[model samples]
Target chain A: MESVGLVPVLCVSVVLFVTGVAGVLTRKNALIVFMSVELMLNAVNLSFVAFARQNGEADGMIYAVFVMAVAAAEAAVGLAMVILLFRNRVTVKLDDLDIMKG
Target chain B: MPTFNDLWLASPALLLFFGAMAIMLGEAIVRPASKTGFWALALGTLAGSAALTVVIFLGPSADAFGGMLRVDQFGLFAQLVCTLAALLTVLFSDDYLRALNLRVGEYYSLVLFGVCGMGLMCLANDLMMVFVALEVMSISMYVLCALKRGDPRSVEAGFKYFILGAFSSGLMLYGISFLYGATGTTSLPGIGGFFMGQHQGTQATLVAIGGALLIVGFGFKVASVPFHMWAPDVYQGAPISVTSLMSAGVKAASFAAFARFVYGVIGTHSAGFVGVLWWMAAATMVVGNLGALAQRDLKRMLAYSSIAHAGYLLMALVAASTGNASNNPALASLLFYLLAYTFMNAGAFIVLAAFTRDGQDYTDIDSLAGLGKRHPWLAAGLSLCLLSMAGIPPTMGFVGKFYLFSAAIQSGQVPLAMIGALSAAAGVYYYLRPMVWMYMKEGHTEARVAPVAFTALAICGFALLAFGLVPGPMLGLAQTSLQSLIPYTIPTH
Candidate 1:
């Protein structure tokens, strides 16, 4: 099998991460914000897998699996919270959920 | 080969995890209308975990689960602190939950699960383990915060916390991947070993960037300044018991893992990181205290107080990283302060939870007016907690702060200590306001107290006084726990 270069892979991962961070900071829709978080996690997984392949070690791959599992759990909880928030406030906008602001 | 000894070493976390599962299964099968049974079961699990922690503490320390976890005094002591906080939360929660009509079987199970995650965090020896354990703890907490389903505030708190928590976790995972790439290993000790050896230029840069990201991640967890925007909102919005648990258990567990990573893995190898922590500590203290002064809500005030306390604890981290690694007084003081914080901060929340009934929380500082006349015991208990939080004499907070500031000074970080002292002084006004409201202000009296919550408050107040008066034992315990980390002599001067 042919080998993929490392710098390009890392560069893509960094782009994905920055995009995710921007989405999270800029987006108002709760679902979109959560999707952004997922994107960031996926970016992390990409880097982990790339590192694992580059080093020819299983550790990074194992970590990637763990991160995926955590991301899944986070998604479950996040969706549940979104449903709850929508039920309580009839809106899923982050700005509208500011009843407890200082 | 892995042996039974490894299981024994991980027994505390294992017990809590199994206990959490058992409660979930039992709730499913039995479908009990009241959560009393689940409460008892949760308490039993925490007690069992605490017992296992003591046993592990008394026994020899060892690596378990292929070095993913370690059984050492440092981790065990943190486990003990977490278990104690969980136990108290369970003890204080039953009536509060019932009062709020939020009692559910899942609450106890989630608390148990959260403690399990905390225990694992304390013992985590690998970056993967830390990430997994942190998620386990945080996910459970996110759910618990929103467990008051109909409350808009609770739902908001949960949503906000989940978003921020997940975002930070992603950042941390990316950082961990970088560290893994640089060191070619995810193990904490391996990372340390790799860093100790001369590194290539790219590897060194990766480690530096990775370390910076790691700080950002933990910085969120500990609610340091610039990352503390979520704390007051979350604390005020969650149920009081959950808030108490978050402030005490979550903070302690995160600090435990953070300390291990900084001291055990990175040691004093990176002066740049120490400088970053120094600035973080100073800024956190100033910002947390200054932000707290504008709060009228008791919970929000306490939230800011917790942030300021995080600042003080971060100072200990700064001292540990900047000065000697092992036998560092600052490190011991960190443990001491966490223990002290667990009691007093949680106790204050218990007092607030005491007044809550029928899904309504009277958390305004003004509502506490005339409580001194109506409920003397409740008033006294809360007063002691508040005084302790204010770092008054004959309180655990005082001793903890004394040790922390002294250690900072001993390490020649006098300016940092001075900033901490000044901010802490500014903090005293808000901490004392509740007491003034209870005693002096003339307002209506409609306060009620729950038996279990009162008992929890009494325990916290007693610990505050006892530890403050005779800090020798807890101090010794904190000092002894530091032996498992890097070794260094306390400076004679």
Candidate 2:
């Protein structure tokens, strides 16, 4: 069990999640933001799998699978929306999509 | 082995899922000339599910599907409220969609699908089930928000909701992973048992962090302060019917699961976490009310009001957390408030939908001027709903607020209750402005009303008045529904 510790796996997950959150906050392109969201989800999946391995339980692994399925479904719908927006507004930049404001 | 009993236990959500598929197939094959057929089918399905939920509530409470879902009175109550909200959305959507020239077969199907997700959420006993159910509901809503493809605002609303929703889900998943690492289980009951047996352990900090992250995810869904930036824009941009569903059904479902997680699993382990919620409740009330005060668009105003209402609900959670085991008045109050919010808020949106004529919503406050003189019924209906929203006397909203604030005080959360009361007082100003414009001011009288929408408004107003005048029966129901939750509460061992 000492080949790789749970602490290192968790640390890597945290770094990936932080990077993904940073990308989401800083990226202007809608597609890039969407990809970053996926990255965050994957980071979560890694942690879930790692914990599942450490505990020798299938529950976390099963949850990680469900998360992947949901992520895929979300991406499909999100990309469709981005395409629709591009068709109507001729742009995919987050800043340019603001038509309604206070 | 999974048996017929499991299917029977999950009949409400199952019925909605099957109904959604039926609508999709019927739309593809039959291709009804008018949307009336689809609307009737959708409403019938929701009504059936609600009836089934009541039946389940009457029979017995049991855990089904290997403990993934729990069929209890509490869950059934939430399911009933969600179905009722969806039924009302369908009733009001018929005319609004026709007026907007956005009639499509997929709308009814998506509503059914969304309600199905909500129903599942009400019954989820495991974290994985909760995550899946939430995604199902949110994805359907994103599509529903963008159904009006030609409207730029609708597209933008859908996009923004999708991005933020996905990001929040990621946060929640990370938290769940941490929780699994700490407790070595994903079942709420298992986690509760683990926490009950162990106190101030090495994993305490991890569990606490996981709980906080879970709150953040739920905060986003419920539109609480600091995570509520998307609400006003999305609410203003989406079709009014969809907004009604979001405010009523989605909020109810999220709160049901959230309350279950906090009270059942976290229990007294939430001591440090309660401080975070206390401040969140206070800030949510202040920010939501202050934000609404500056809004000219009625939809945006209502969105902010919804955020403020979430704050009051959060206060109920705070009170419940501190209360004793014998009777959970705060939980009852939260359930009752969700029901009251469903009727009043959806009714107001129906009134706003009534003003649409040619695919555009005339929801600006100025457009409502002279409405009382021109359309007395419409104006009166909106006034009743708005008054309820303001928590005025002789309305359900008033009773709901009374219960919530009193519960907080009972739990010794007097300061939190005070913050809520103050924000609500400020909220009254914006709620009354619409009534003032409707009755006192005189302007263009071009607003049009649909018969169905008006009927919805009348029903909502009646409910608000009836429930407000005598809240005993509904309060009793809310109390009874909470009985099943007592066993799940984790006790420090």
Top candidate, metric lDDT: 2
Grade the docking of candidate 1.
high
Q: Which stretches of candidate 2 lie over 4 Å from their true place?
A: A1-3, B199-202, B487-493
Interface RMSD of each: 0.7, 0.7
Q: Put down candidate 1 lDDT per residue, B135-220, tens digits, no spaces.
A: 88999999999999999999999999999999998888889999988878888888877766677788988998898999999999
State the displacement of the C-alpha of residue B172, model 2, in Å, after optimal TM-score superposition. 0.4
Q: What is the TM-score of chain A in candidate 2?
A: 0.95
Where model 1 places Cα greater than 4 Å from the true spot, the runs are B487-493
TM-score of 1: 0.98
lDDT of 1: 0.89
Task: List, residue by residue over A58-84, the lDDT tens digit for candidate 1.
Answer: 878888888888888888889988999
Which pairs of residues collide in candidate 2? none
TM-score of chain B of 1: 0.97
Query: What shift in Å separates residue B233 of candidate 1 from its native position after superposition?
Result: 0.4
